[model samples]
Target: MKDVARVIVTYDCPRNCPNCCNEHIGDVPAVKFEDLLKYKELVITGGEPMEIAPRVVEMIHRLQANGYNGKLWLYTSCLKTTKWADRAVLQAVNGITYTLHHKPSQKDLSDVCKLNKYLLENLDNRAHDRSDRLLIDSRCYTEEVLRIIGLYDTGTKHWSSIKPLEWKDDECPIPDNEELIYYDLERV
Candidate 1:
């Protein structure tokens, strides 16, 4: 497993990606800065972290203040970074990963791309004294599971059929006689 802790701070996102495990995440406690100490990298995710920009900034500041010098990675939709305050928060983080999902309109993509361009330019200028860790979707992984099984091609559809897992009948909830099969789509 990767030596990274994915701390999800909120279950409230504007776009409900079909593959998201947000329902299972529930209302977990907000992350304290100390929670990041055990890992080399800390990924602050959410329904969308930008949903609570001020709180995110506080988390970053707290981690920095406590002398936790690990790399901080932010996973966001790039929707809220359009605001100056949110951009400032992004400027503080070491790296960012933008989530690419179903965009209903070209305008949405345009706005996100605009912010992406700005972050690429501003967050990587050594002459301007910013960190050199600005990133797009550069995940170091052997495999990726595109869980678009429940995804819609467009619009506000959600994963209504797949509810959060529930324990029942004194056993885990796999079908009694079903054999689970996994397929390897590609090899890295």
Candidate 2:
């Protein structure tokens, strides 16, 4: 566990968003699974991570299997694929924050509710709180959208929340002394 790092899993997104910064970045070198163990927190972001869902989870499993106990948080819109609903998406990582650019309909909110409930029932809250979250575009943020999705009673002040979006430019710069291994971004 050392410095914080963000692995730009990929820039190849299916949607062309006005606020998206994926296309603004340079060539992203593929990252190594072992190299990822150096960070205390690894933020897995991309054009859309769920686009390559299986590989994403595989890398997560690999990290945990190798005794990496640090935080593994992912950033995705969950718009392109249903892979977000996969069990390991929540189980394998400490958190998955869905940054959506569009307004969520009743159906979409309901689906999120269903998944949040499922995670609450199955995961070990005693160890980790429900870090899964939703980030609606600030333009899409409505007063009615600010409701408690769920609360975790594991003595940790954590719960799934719907909030406005924040951008850190297009992508994070690769840190010094660290190779930006792309193993989880592309097919390994």
Candidate 3:
């Protein structure tokens, strides 16, 4: 059985990386926090959860206060960890997953590594091994649907009248409802 439930807390990310698959980043509903405790782990994600740092920390505290003992994993771009407030909020989580693709320079990579090392050294190690405390992924997910969410074919549309509007031939079709529920964010 899958014990982890990856929560899309918000779709408010500010980065414009080409491989983004989260189309709902600017206008998606936040997941109900209480609904997450039934799983063994809750992975909180957003356009950038740290974008609203305080709220995310409050939600984490709320989860703990409500007797949810499962791990709380956070997904981030590692852009705001340099800020003391954001760093504190991140350290509170049980584990962290960073999108390595977002690192634009050696400085960003160095910061990410330093932050991950600190997190691995400081957070409780009950549910995660030291090596598992931080995860870095080049592409957030390997699944085709998840790697290409906002893209669409504009066939027969206004400008496409000249030619069939097409997404990159390599692009994968978005999944239907049945396929979506089975997506494994932990693997991303």
Best-performing candidate as measured by lDDT: 2
Sorted by TM-score (best first), the order is 2, 1, 3
Residue 16 displacement in candidate 1 (angstroms): 2.1
The digit string of per-residue lDDT tens for model 1 on 61-88 reads: 7678888787776667645556865776
The RMSD (Cα, Å) of candidate 2 is: 4.9
- Which ten-residue region of model 3 has the weakest summed lDDT? 154-163
**Which stretches in model 1 have alpha-carbon errors above 4 Å?**
24-32, 125-188
Local accuracy by lDDT, each model: 0.50, 0.62, 0.50
Q: How does each model score on TM-score?
A: 0.58, 0.68, 0.57
Query: What alpha-carbon RMSD in Å does predicted model 1 have with respect to the real structure?
Result: 14.2
lDDT of 2 by residue, 83-181 (tens): 553566666677777665565666655555555566556653445664767676787566454442332322213345656775455664455643343
Cα deviation of 52 in candidate 2 (Å)? 1.7
List, in order, the clash count of every candidate structure.
Answer: 0, 6, 3
